[model samples]
Target: MKIKYAIIGAGPTGLGAARRLNELGEKSFIVLEKNSYAGGLASSFTDEKGFTWDIGGHVVFSHYEYYDNLLVEILVDEYLEHQRESWVKSGKVWVPYPFQNNIRYLPNQKKWECVRGLLPGERSEEEPANFFEWIINTFGKGIADHFMLPYNFKVWATYPEMMSFSWIGERVSVIDLKTVIKNILLERDQLSWGPNNTFRFPLKGGTGSIYRNLAETLSNHILYNTSVVSVDQKNKIITDSLGNTFEYEFLLSTAPLDILVTKWLEKSPETLINAADMLKHNGVIVVGIGISTSKKDSRCWMYFPDDNSPFYRVTNFHNYSPNNTPVPGQGRALMCEVSYSEHKFVDQNKVVDDVEEGLVTTAMIDDEDRKNIISRWSINVNYGYPIPCLQRDEALKILQPALESMDIYSRGRFGGWKYEVSNMDHSVMQGVEWAERMITGQPETTYRIS
Candidate 1:
């Protein structure tokens, strides 16, 4: 008897799994997407003026060759490779990224404080119990106290002490003392240190184009506007929102683990319930501002670590592609700003006003620049960045095996609930590898930290 499979969620992970199944001649599958379209959090939308904006902001950085190979196969001729130019805005200083390494730009007293914190001392035999301790140990107290602690609070919407350090492998950069001193002495900007030194973006049609291409490949098997409302693991049946039921031999769920356990499992475990309650996520408010300036050259994305700006980051969406906004002769530049918070009941009008005020305060736009404002729109995503809080690992440890026991594999950014491997490339490869594992019982590289 042939094995039948049913995939829940039409995001990158589910699509990847479907692609892999197709390649292996396994046609016994159906993709159920809740939304009217594909690409979960990574989807795109166009405003009334034809400007393209992503859900928040997404960039593709891959560590796996298979991921790259598959993208090349699908995207074919529709991708643009870009070098990353990122910076942190602290106070009035435009410090280079890995702000700790560029402390020479700081005051002498602060510099000395950092050095004092780094003096070789009695190392703790025990491991760091929280994110704050881990950062202090890795970058010293100066960097952590000055930037890491405060900036992270703004971004993650949680206190550092409340977060765990187990997710800090390649996600956070660990500065080398020798290199730091050398760069500071030489007054050099260490631009080539991290995983995102060079990356790719879709040349046209925005980041969603990649997903659109993936969906095009499996157009026949994908079922849009079909939301999975419940699942009966014991009976191997999934009921859609429209009251249609489908049976399968295997299940791949990319939905939130909390919802799956609460609604699908036979006897939801108390441990899983507790884990769900512990899981905390930050919401994102993405504001797209279209201006009427001829300044063709602007930084790709700027980091706002200062209090003046409510947004944590801003991407010059037009810089990615001319098509991302109106044409140069026809219109002006476009900027997309992202703000994160844990609360869901934030007033939309208030957020818009705050964002506009922040843009002017940060000097991204002038006070009298209303003439340049051609269009403005906003999108709010409830699950933006997965907070690596102290309880995250405990939740995953208990929830992952429970889902697996029901023959359901959940993978992707929100699916696995991992921010470390939640980039476009990582999420897509997660889907690919999950399929390979299910087909051949192979180990998944994305799940392995080393």
Candidate 2:
């Protein structure tokens, strides 16, 4: 039977689009997943000791009501809510997030520089061209110099000056200058900022469970372990790795835009080539360490921006949910260390060893803790986070229309390629909105937000 819609990539975004179609009483669709599982990066895994780890560190934080409603509808009682408590390790001090607002912890000289930078001067007559300038203008030279510049370079694998600031919306927190000064003088913490003050997590499984359950709802329509080998856009047909072919009236692709254009489109449209060229991404090395420890109170994920640690972030997987790892009575702890790099040939064993050494050097885990090390493994995911470069807008402006002309809707983390809306909820909504737009000719949230 010919399908009304063929959705590729069965991640949250694809599943979300399917779910929305089902809710709207439209069932003439099928989902194609490259992996055997439903969740993409959000998927979970188990080690020999029954310790669970997510692809990276995924926290469930939503900005849209639709995401919240859909997650609740699918997971229901299985969901576990978590209070967001995060800290940044800077200059041998654990400063609370919104690191700018809490600069009292910094040395007096640094603090004075930050305050001085905040002092309003003749505003630059020219538009801030790069992300660094944009950040310096938005948060003052203080915060940018102290944390934003160095930390972002590590995260993006590119200099901030090379990126564009157009993507910044509600993603980064900008401190209230008056409040920051007051807090500094009073030596008090700035309590309020940003959208995700509190968030939710799935209790039984990791964040992937939510996507897994969502896929279960559309099980009949989803075809797993089916990789799309090629697409005949002119003929509206998709051929899988197994040599099976399927035709569709509309194609909604959640695959990375570059891969889709280079592999499927075949013809190098100027827009497609430019989009492919303008895009850059960072790969993630997720290191999961399982140790036998009884310490239960250290709950929140910690951020490391210092050169001492190779990881940018470390999530206490067990704290997110008791079920995330082995039972407490069984005596085990799971910690995830995230490292970002563009080079693919970096030694995995060496990275893992370096991470282990760094953990001890930073006093995150003691040397004696190594005795309880039962299982350790690393997952390397390429195209983990898309970088919003200086030429992204121009690239997208050309690429979006080209895809639309072919009746193809590209949406998701790397599909639409907008970091601001790349979270699970946002990615899912991108799929839903794209499908809705395809069916009803409505405007899509992904493009509209940009």
Candidate 3:
């Protein structure tokens, strides 16, 4: 097939690009999707027992008006809005979301330890060298030792020393001793500290519903189950696993940038090869523990820092929407997330069992509740998180421009290899902005190389 634009992967970014191109009255593009479904990592699945599960715990919220309008157009009133009720599990205590801001909820000794570490001269006065140093220097050794260090290692599945701390803008909550003391004295809970303080979710299809609906509008342009095997950048050609070939003037790949460069791109040089090697990512295993019983927990999700749970976080999935459970308003869908990487190897074969036992250890479910467990569904995501590794920026600078010079643009979560802008909103806008830039001469903003 011949086309003006060929987009790879039908996730938020590809769909966003396709949708925007269509809206702009451009009709000569095709979207080749590997799976029979849309949404990529954002996709959801329904088990035989009729329980819905997202790839992981995905909450719907946006920083882009374009994405906000896109949701309004796609979902209309079919979604549910909820205030964020996120928390952390520390010393069998349900501390508020930002663990640092709510250390006062800890047992008296641990609480005192956290406060003492935050005192003047406790933190390093020198600039941090890496994420680990930054955590200790900015948050003090106590908070780092108690929560930041352990929880982060569990979640990211990569050593903090290997990661750069620049991506901590809106993702992490900063602490101040004055506010921490005031909150402790007045007993104030810092409930809202991040962008997702209030978010939305699909009332029926889990989080994937938005992408599914958006793709439907451009169904004629999307070719499902067509996986791109190789890219002939010199000839502007693409060959899929089905033995079909697509030729395009421009290509937008939402697949992993490493996969695109190292595996797919034809005749790639050593510089690009080494650059792709530096791109670090973590895998996630989503274990959905569905119980035939119900619970009245208002907290949406809770983070685990201690060894009580193999998982770093668990969601009260039932609270996301009553429809998430088989019988509305009944049963609990406790979705647990366990991240793994080579640096932190997890026995995937036994993670489900570990997760169930961890739930018991953390007091999320009782031994009696285990008897009530009806569904044990799990999905092993090979590429769950795109780690902002020490060499990430250096890698992107070398890879993105080299591909763009060949009229290929890689954007979105793994494509851009940027966790900060990997949210649903940012992914979609990356596509939308890519389309806009293609149609007109407007420069892109969301996925900048720098």
The TM-score leader among the candidates is: 3
TM-score of each: 0.92, 0.94, 0.99
Candidate 3, residues 1-450: lDDT per residue as tens digits?
Answer: 999999999999999999999999999999999999998998999888878999998999999899999999899899999999989988778888899998879888888888888899999889788899999988888888899999999999999999999898899998988988898899998888899999999989999998899889999999999988999999999999988999999999999999999999999989999999999999999999999998779999999989778999999999999999999889999999999998888999999999999999999999899999999999999999999999999999999999999999999999999999999999999999999999986999999976
Model 3 compared with the native: what TM-score? 0.99
lDDT (Cα, tens digit) per residue for candidate 2, span 35-121: 999999889888787888888878888878898888788788887777777777887777887788788888788788777777768
Model 1: ten consecutive residues of lowest lDDT: 328-337
lDDT of 1 by residue, 1-450 (tens): 123888888888889889988987888898989888888888888787778888766787788887788889878877778887777776767776767777767667776776666667722335788988887887777777777887787778777888888777777777756766777689887666578877788877788888888898998888899888778788888888889888888888888767787776666778788887777788778888777565644467777766777787878777777777766344544454554565324566677778777888877777666567877888887777788888888788888887788887778887788888887778777888888887788889886422
Q: CA lDDT, every prediction? A: 0.77, 0.80, 0.93
Prediction 1 TM-score vs. true: 0.92
Off by more than 4 A, model 3: none
Judged by whole-model lDDT over C-alpha atoms, candidate 3 comes out at: 0.93
Q: Rank the candidates by TM-score, best first.
A: 3, 2, 1
